[model samples]
Target: MSERVTPSAEAARALRDIERRRGQARAADQESRWVGVVFGVAIFAELAAPDFFGDGVRSWIGLAVAVLGCVYVVMLRTPRGGALLGRPTRLRKDELSPRFVWLARLAILAVMLIGPFGLRFLPQAPFPYTRTVVGAVLGATLIIFGRTLQRALTSLALRRDDKDGLGGATYGSR
Candidate 1:
C-alpha cells in the first residue's frame, strides 16, 4: 500500500504560498498609498462635485483597504508569510516583533477603513467630503511602515554581519 500525501499537507502548502504572496502584497501595499496620493493630488484641483460622489469615493477606499488588510492578516497568520517575514535569512528574529507588526497593521487597517469614512462624513475634519483623507492617512502609514520594515530587514543583515565578524554590524540594539 502506498501512503498518499494528506489533504492537510496540501492545504498547509497552499497557505504557505498565500503567506508569501501576502508579504509581497504588504510591500506592494506601501506602494498603493503612494499611488493614492498621486490620484488624490490629481483630483485636488477639482473645485466642485456632487455630495454623493464623495460618498462613493469613501466607500471605495474603505473597501479597498479592508480587502488588502484581509489579505495581509491571512498571510501573516499562515506559515508562508510568517516564514518570509521572519525567516532568519531575511529578517532577524528580534526584528520581526510580532507585537509591533500586528499593532501597526491593525492601525493601518482601521485607518484605511475609518479614514475614508471620515472623509465622507467627518464634519469636524477639513476635506470631510473631499475623499483625500484616505490617501493622506494611507500615505502617512506607509511612510512609517516602510521605515519599520526596512529596519526589520536591516536587523537581520546586521545579525548576519555580526556572525561573519564583518566589523560593520550596527542594528538591533533598540
Candidate 2:
C-alpha cells in the first residue's frame, strides 16, 4: 500500500488542537477572575454611590450590572473542584492562607471600629470622618472575602498536604 500522511503527520493540525484547548482554559480562568473583580467593584460602587449624572440611584444601577456580570461569568466557568462526580479537576481542598493575613485583617478591622469615632473629633470636621467610615466598610468587606477564601483554600491545601505530605504552605497564590 502507498504510504499515506496520517493525522499524526500533520503538525499544524495538532498545534491547532492544542491551541484551541489552551484558549478554552484561558477563557475559563478569565471568567473566574472577572466574576471576582466585578463582584468587588459592584459592592464598592453601591457603597460609594458616586454622584454620576447627579442621580443618586446610578450607583445602584452599577451594582445591578455587576451582579448580572458575575452571574453570566459564573455560568461560563465550571467550578474547578466540588462535590461533582467528574474526571477530578483540582482536589476539593488544595489551598492555604498567607502569613499574618488573618491577624493583620483583624487589626485593620479593630482600628476601623475605633477610627470613625476618632475622626468625628478631628479639626477638619466631617470630611475625614466620612472618608474613614467608607474606607473602614470597604476594608471590612475585603477582609471578609479574604477570610472566606482562606477557609476554602486552607481546606484544599490541607487535603493535598495530608495526601502527599507537601508541607502545606503557600503565599497568596489565590
Candidate 3:
C-alpha cells in the first residue's frame, strides 16, 4: 500500500510557501521603485539648481546631488551585507536583465551629466526655462521607470501565483 498524505497538511504547506514567496516579491518591488524615484529626484534637483541658486551656489548644490546619487548607486552595487538598500528575496533572474539594468544606469548618468548644459542647445535660453524643461524630462523618465518596475513586479507575481497553483487572482488585482 502507498503511504497516504493528508490533504489539509499539503494545503497548509503550499499556503505557507506561497506566502513566503509573495513577501519576497513585494520587498523586491518596493526596493526597485524606491531606487528609481531617488535617482530621478536627484537628477531633477541637480538640474534645477540653476533656477534657484546663483552660479556659485548652484555649482555646489549640483555637486552634492550628484555625489548622493553616486553613493546610492554604489551602495546598490555592493554585496548583500554592505547594501544600504534591502535585498530582494524572490525576484526572478529574468525579471530584471543585467544588460537592461546597466543600460538604464548609464542612461540616467548621462542625463544627469548632460542636463545642466541643455540650455546651450538654444543660445541665450533663459535659465529658468532650461531648468524647468530639464526637470520635467527627468521627472518623466522616473515615472517611466516606475511603471516599468511595477509591470515587472506584477508579471513576476502573476508567474509565481500560477506556479503555486494559486489561480488567476493576481497579487495586485482585487
Q: Residue by residue across 50-146, what tens digits does model 1's lDDT show?
A: 2435544655655655676576566555556644434212233443446666776898999899966866885554555443555455455545465
Which of the numbered candidates is closest to the native, going by highest TM-score? 3
Give all TM-scores, in the order shown.
0.32, 0.30, 0.48
Measured by lDDT, the strongest candidate is 3
Q: Which ten residues in a row have the lowest lDDT in candidate 2?
A: 82-91
Worst window of 10 by summed lDDT in candidate 1: 165-174
> Rank order by TM-score, top first?
3, 1, 2
Query: How do the residues 9-127 of candidate 3 rate in per-residue lDDT, one tens digit apiece?
Result: 99899889877765555545445456667777777777666766656667787678778867866765565522345543334444444556677689899998896677468677565
Higher-TM-score candidate among 1 and 3? 3
User: Local error of candidate 3 at 151, Å?
Assistant: 5.1
Candidate 3 wrongly placed segments (more than 4 Å): 1-23, 32-41, 77-84, 88-120, 126-128, 136-174
List per-candidate RMSD values in Å.
15.0, 11.8, 7.9
lDDT of candidate 1? 0.47
Candidate 2's clash total is: 7
